[model samples]
Target: MTAELEARIELAQAVERGASVLSSRVVEAFLNVPRHPFVPAFYRRDGAKYVPTRGHNDAWLRAVYADDVLVTEVGGVHVEDAPDCGVTGVATSSSTAPGLMAEMLDALDVRPADRVWEIGTGTGYNAALLCHLAGAATVTTVDRTARLVDAAQGRLHEVGFAPAVLRADGAGTPPAGGPFDRIIATCAVRRVPTAWLEQCVTGGVIVAPIGNALGGGAVVHLTKLPDGGGGGGGGGDGPIH
Candidate 1:
């Protein structure tokens, strides 16, 4: 096998070990999904600027296989579009850390027949994993940015996944595919959207990172109840992370 492929496998195994992801399905998804294609270019902070990887070589391969989060966009400027010197601004989006992603997916507890709605189609990486766990036809992913949605759709297709990728406000309108058996948000939200609760089947799981005003957050796993209320582990108040 190529060294890069070996590195990716090792990284997946390391993430599984570090995150304690017990589900074989989750582990297999992590091992199989190619993270590099989703993040063709990412920013590496250098001083006050965010520099893009020089080229897709060994260094880039090493970075992609790493378990760390890679910033794919800064201030709405995608890394591929940024100047050589790099862009400076808040990170508007990123590929979440592999360990954290595995944790959240484990919490999601996806099943083969489960229909899933993923909110934050950043790199299409998480959505790809969801497609691996469930079937691609059973997964629907949405993002607010049209550019991101378009790019993610193409990349997902390249990876033999063609889940329903849409450009819409995930917290607002419910996509036609629901009521989903599982709903996951890669982005943070201050409050759980009522639409999510409405779109999810009763007893379905909603896993997301919830932040608080204290600058702290935790990944929460909530279950939709028969009365339309949500109850699960962890509690915090802030935007979804």
Candidate 2:
């Protein structure tokens, strides 16, 4: 088998082992949608500085497939723009750990016809996976910065995904497409965005990391109520866990 294929298989297995839901669809998404194309270059912390690393070589490709979070930006500086000497700053954006992504995606329970709205389209890797789960044309992803939106759009197109990559604050209005079936946030928020809730369908799911703290605490699986309530919904709805 090819090295990239082997690496992706290893990644799929690793993510599968850690994920709470043993979803064959999620595993297939990992194996089919490559992580390297989304992150051509990323930052790896070395001492006090974050070093820029390119994904042109075999080792880098393997690292890309690894279940670790790859920091693609530091203090708004994309890895490709960073100096060779490196720089130290807070990670502004990153491609999340595959295991966590798998867990969250499983919680989202995206189906083929589901209209998904994704918050924080960093590197567009998650968006691509969403496309695999749902459909590319049906997925809409937004990011805070224009740079992220533009870059993510380019990379997504490179890998054959053409989701609606928009430049907007995820906390603000829900973007053009409304009444989304599934709304997911990649970043932690202080509280559920009212606009996000406004846009989601009555029985639709909203999965997000609910925490104001640094790394986030828990992921909440909320279903929109018929009365437009925050917590509970529908007769046969499951509890948010």
Candidate 3:
């Protein structure tokens, strides 16, 4: 294999070895999904290297595999697009970095046959991973951008994985296929959306980033109370362990 490819493999392996600290399902998803495919050519031109706007490139690649989060885009623009400007577009969405995703999954504690609702389905990478764990038929993802929704849906289909993907604002609860066992938001929210709480099943989990400012990347893990109408909130801090 090429050096970059080899390095990526090693990175993935490292993440797998650390799975004891991560959710088993999340680790499996990282090993199964190819980050290279989702990364843009600008940052990934060197194969496995994750060259950021500034900083040590090698350190970034390792971070990608670790349980830490990586910002693939700023605003609506891919980081590679205008690295020098450091300007953010609108903060669309991303497949939460491998490390953060693991913690989120660990917090959710999804089980087989669990029906999942994934909001802000950016590239569909996260949805694909969830499907791999919960079964594609049990996963449904939504995005506000039609382009994003279509692209994610197409990618899932191309990979022979089928998950319900739709173009809709994630501000409200998903109507069909919910009363979900788990709900994950790939984007950020300032306040808990009552609609989301309303649709989650009793004892279900809702994992999302509760913030509006950049760099406020804390992942919030909420478990629905027995009534399925309320939740207790906690900041997720399970390291890239």
Candidate 4:
């Protein structure tokens, strides 16, 4: 096998071993989904500036397979569109680390026929993984930034998975897709959006990272109760253990 593929397999196995109870489907998705295509170029913070991976060289490939978050956009500028000198600003979007993704997917407990609505499309990696678990037709991902959404759509298509990728605000009303069986957000939200609750079917699952003013965060796994309210528990300041 090629070195890159070997590295990817090792990374997937490491993630699987680290998880307490990751489903087999989740493990397969992690092993097969190509993370490099989704994040063609990412930034490495060098002091005040962000440095882009020069090319798809050995270093870039190693970083792609690493169990680490990759910053793809900073200060509204995507790494692919940034100047050669690099950009300076807060990171606006990123590819979530594989370990965290596996935890959230485990919490979601996605089934084969489940219809999932993903809030943040970012690199499209998570959406692709969802498509792998739940058929592509049942997966829909939305992002507020048109550029990011468009790029993600193209990348997903390149990977032969074409789920519904839309450009809309995830915090607002859910997309016109309909009541979904699962709703997940890669971005941090201050509170669970009521629209998300309203869009999810009874007994559906919603997994998201909720942020607090104290700079702490938690991954909340809420189930839509019969009364259309959320009920469940959450893990604080770390991956759901």
Worst 10 residues of 3 by lDDT: 40-49
TM-score of 2: 0.92
Highest lDDT model number: 4
Q: Estimate every model's Cα lDDT from 0 to 1.
A: 0.84, 0.83, 0.66, 0.85
lDDT per residue (tens digit) for residues 76-178 in model 2: 7888899987889898777878888887788788999799999888888999999999999899999887888898899899989999999988888777777
lDDT of 3 by residue, 119-196 (tens): 777767677778888889898888887767776787788767898998888886465987799988877778669888
lDDT of 2 at 46: 96
Error of 4 at 40 (Å): 0.8
Q: What TM-score goes with each of the models?
A: 0.94, 0.92, 0.75, 0.94
Q: Count the backbone clashes (under 3 Å) in each candidate.
A: 8, 0, 5, 0
lDDT of 4 by residue, 181-224 (tens): 99998787888999999999999999988884222498899999
Model 2 CA deviation exceeding 4 Å by range: 232-241
Regions of candidate 3 where Cα sits further than 4 Å from its true position: 1-9, 16-20, 40-93, 236-241
- Model 1 residue 21 lDDT score: 35
Instruction: Rate residue 220 of model 4 by lDDT.
Output: 92
